[model samples]
Target chain A: MKYYNWGIIGLGEIATSFTNSFQQENSQITAVASRTLSKAVAFANEHDIPKAYGSFEALLADQAIDIVYIAVPNRQHIEHILKALAAGKHVLCEKAITMNSAELTQAMTLAEEKGLILAEAMTIFNMPLYQELRSQIDSNRFGKLKMIQAPFGSYKEPDPSNRFFNPDLAGGALLDIGTYAVSFARWFFTSQPKVIASVMQPFSTGVDEQSATILQNDVQEMATVSLSFQAKMPKQGVVAFEDAYIVINEYPRADEAKIFFNDGTVETIVSGDSTQALNYEITNMIKMIEGETSNRSLFLTKDVIDLLDQMQQNWTN
Target chain B: MKYYNWGIIGLGEIATSFTNSFQQENSQITAVASRTLSKAVAFANEHDIPKAYGSFEALLADQAIDIVYIAVPNRQHIEHILKALAAGKHVLCEKAITMNSAELTQAMTLAEEKGLILAEAMTIFNMPLYQELRSQIDSNRFGKLKMIQAPFGSYKEPDPSNRFFNPDLAGGALLDIGTYAVSFARWFFTSQPKVIASVMQPFSTGVDEQSATILQNDVQEMATVSLSFQAKMPKQGVVAFEDAYIVINEYPRADEAKIFFNDGTVETIVSGDSTQALNYEITNMIKMIEGETSNRSLFLTKDVIDLLDQMQQNWTN
Candidate 1:
């Protein structure tokens, strides 16, 4: 059995969630790092990690860490990923992979030169349930796909101090929740659609509080997506085909899904474990590090990056 | 008192909702019309309407019917409203007043020549809750107005036979629910903003199932909106200002609203009656007919029509 030692480069909420998930999976969190030594020490102690570093650079220097998970804010993703790649460590970076595709391209090039595995940590893209959904579509079970709608949002009391609504942190609904919806649209469609229309609400900090986007391909196939930080939502995505429809209950990172056929038959697929999707991404990264695969699926990562770039350019906040 | 007797041009579901709402108010339904006399007569008997006509033309021919409410499908709205105006009757048409603004301009010109009230029946625009929300923003109670997020959708089994998804009838989210969200954004901002981004999904009948939109004005204020028919959604809109937020529980004619101030004071304003917004429009029209007001609120009606027209032009459906 092959196992890779993992190091997390941030001690934020997401990073903690990933660490807890990894612990449940019997994966090793070899080290943890944060800007503050006390925070890093507390997290490391809480997670029973073997090492804690005072700074990101120190964590990158740890030779035993085979892979690094970059869970920093959006603006810092590229910088941290490039640093980890230069250090000869495999990298799994969070969504909105970089500030834009230009940065993504630069990181991809650097990773290729270093012969290091670099994957955008979009766990939903590799989920068994999503794969099954794609299989069903590929098999033409739903007939010709016509439309897709997904909305993910939540009401968070405005706190200027939170990274989510901070403009300097590249924070907003689009870069955050919208990225998930847009990525799903791009993944299923496999083409860049023109943004035919859009409406957005900018927060006081010049970041989007909520946004709705309408994208269409040359053939007029369309997808509508909504993301917000202004209301409570039951995360969902529905794909309507000519003969049937697929309803994803908890979309973007759905664990269970159902396909409703025109013939009145229902097919259900449930991902057995309720584990966070980060576990799957991290597990995949370890496999790649052990020479199990050539590189993270280029098509999926490119799709995410391209979609993010287009969305960021399309939206000012 | 110039009590202009009203003729309803369609006995559809929306027409029924409107009539039910009007029954609670002072408005009188003088006549009801449908293509089938049996259907019109049944509706008249059920609602206690005074007159039933077999055809729309018959209703128009009746010299006693002073005004006409065109509640037909979107594609027929232009034809019916134009004919009603041409028949020397004041017109209060449904939202998406016409297929496009060009038709609106033509109708407005005709109404002007005839010295009649040609108002788009946008109930939300006439609602007391919306007016209160506007007042809060105007008074800077919520500080500098920033963003508005609203979504309205429902999950209903898609039947190709239904008018909602039928492209031939100009049915889609944009013309249906999208019109409400889009119009609300424009109304709140009080300006026509350029569409910064958009995404849409087409239905089996070549109509939009869902649409997400983002818009930004020259002043840098933005509004985000989402509209769909593919999922069940809570009816709501959140208007976020710099220092406070107003939460509207039932949007598109909210029955009640809560305003939360930064100082921790929450004020709940109950909406007038459970009546649909159309009654408010009917009341306004009645007042206009009585010569209480010189002309229709052109700014409100024009802004709404212009917004819907611009959004439709970008339709991917």
Candidate 2:
């Protein structure tokens, strides 16, 4: 087994939860970096990480760190990923990999040229239940797939200081909750949609607080995704076929799925433990870094970003 | 108690189901009509109706009938509704009142001019559970409402002979499944949506098999509705507020609701009996005809039709 040493950049709230993935034997959070030395030291001590760096560059220069997990704000993702790549570190950046398709392409191209594994840490793509659903769809378990529906929402107050409501931080529903819903559509369809139509309710920050999008491919496969920061949503994802449908509740970290057939029979599927939902993606990233497998998440991340970009463009036009 | 004697205009599948609402006291299906004499006779005999007419005109000519329920093809709804109004019969037409908003207006105007109780026979609008949910929403049981989502789908084989795929029959997902979803949005919002966006996948017969729509009002309140004839959907609806949400399954005839709050407490609400879900709407129609209450379903029906019409126009342009 190849051991993976992780150095984390930007210690935020999500970074704290992300440490759960390092609770395994082969993976360890060796270092953590924050702009404030005190914050870095506190995080390292709390998480049992060995090294704490006061600056991101100092953490990048640590030769013992084989990988860097960037947990910064959306605007800084590209910068941090590029800097880490320059330092020859494989990367697992957070979702909304870049602001637009062009930026995502630039970062992905550089990673490819350097022969480094660059992946987005979108946990849904790595969930065992999601994978099983994908396999079942491919094997025609539900007959011909016809439609998919995914909705995600969270009641975030309109506090201007919060990154979610700040336009300058690339904060909005689309880049955050919307990405997961769109990613599910892309993964299930395996083709870029022929048409995309969307509408949004803009916030005072000029970012969308609520938006609905429709994606339809040439094969007649369709997906409807609704994203909001104004409501408490269940975040359920559904994939429907001519004969049956599969529903994944809280799909981003999905552990359970329920399938209902046309014949009135119901089947429930449970996969990995819910608390360890992030472990599969971390292991997948390690495999990508070890050259045992290419990063499939990279391609899906690009598709999702491209679609969101096109949707926004369509809305404006 | 006032008795309502219903006259049916068409002997179709929906007409059979509509008769279920008459199972309660103070409501009776006294007469029915079909173009074919044998069908009319067979249907009336099967349902134990007192009279059967070989032609729609004969049914309308029946003086004892207090109201006529139009269950003809969608394209024929406007024509049939007008004729019933002209005959001075209060009317309860099946959903999708007309081909478009213009036709709906014409039909509703005639109903108003005749002082008849004209309404869309949408079961969800009258379901007891839906009424309770609406009351709870008004009472702020879930706090301020922010979003509403209703998705309905079914696996309809694209048989050319079937009305579901016949453009001449005004057949499509919109007129069929989409109506319920759209009506729910209109009922909750109580205002014409300022924005409507949609995308559709058409069948080989040139009728839409699936559609996704987004409707938003001025208060930033929004609803996303998805309808399909290509898949088997769970037909659940959700109303989300700042602090809680209510979920209704089998929404068209919903008898149960589950309320989930942010505090991890869940409340399950059961209203009318599931088997008699249609009775509430039938009673409401009777009340409407008795002049006890004006038909609220008419106004909402018009709003929904207008929104669907605008979405199609937007798509084509």
In terms of TM-score, the best-performing candidate is 2
Worst 10 residues of 1 chain A by lDDT: A230-239
In model 2, what is the error at residue A287, expressed in angstroms?
A: 0.6
Per-residue lDDT tens digits for candidate 1, residues B1-317, read: 65568899988888998888784244588999999999999999999999999999999999998999999887898888888988999998887787877887888899889988887777677777777677767786665555666666655468777778777878787777776777677667746677665556677887777666667677655566666676544456766555666677667777787876655678887866546577777887777777886553555667666766666666633
TM-score of chain B, candidates 1 onward in order: 0.92, 0.95
DockQ (C-alpha based) per candidate is: 0.16, 0.72
lDDT tens readout by residue for model 2, A1-317: 77778999999988998996566677798999999999999999998889999999999999998899999988899999989998999999888778898888888888988888899988877877777777877888888878888888888877976889899888889998888888877888857774467878787888888887778887778888888887778888888888998888888887899999988999999887667766776888888777787777788888889889987886677
Please give, for residues B1-317, the per-residue lDDT of candidate 2 as tens digits.
67778899988887887785566577789999999989999998998999999999999999999889898888898889999999999888888878899998888788779888888888777877777888888887777777888888898876976989888888889888888888877777846785467777788898888877778887777788888898889888888888888888887877898988877799999998767755676888887777787777788888888888987786677
All-Cα superposition RMSD per candidate = 5.7, 2.2
lDDT of 1: 0.74
Query: Which 10 residues in a row give candidate 2 chain A its minimum summed lDDT?
Result: A190-199
Give lDDT tens digits, candidate 1, residues A100-169: 7788889989988998888878766666677677777789776665566666666667876687889888
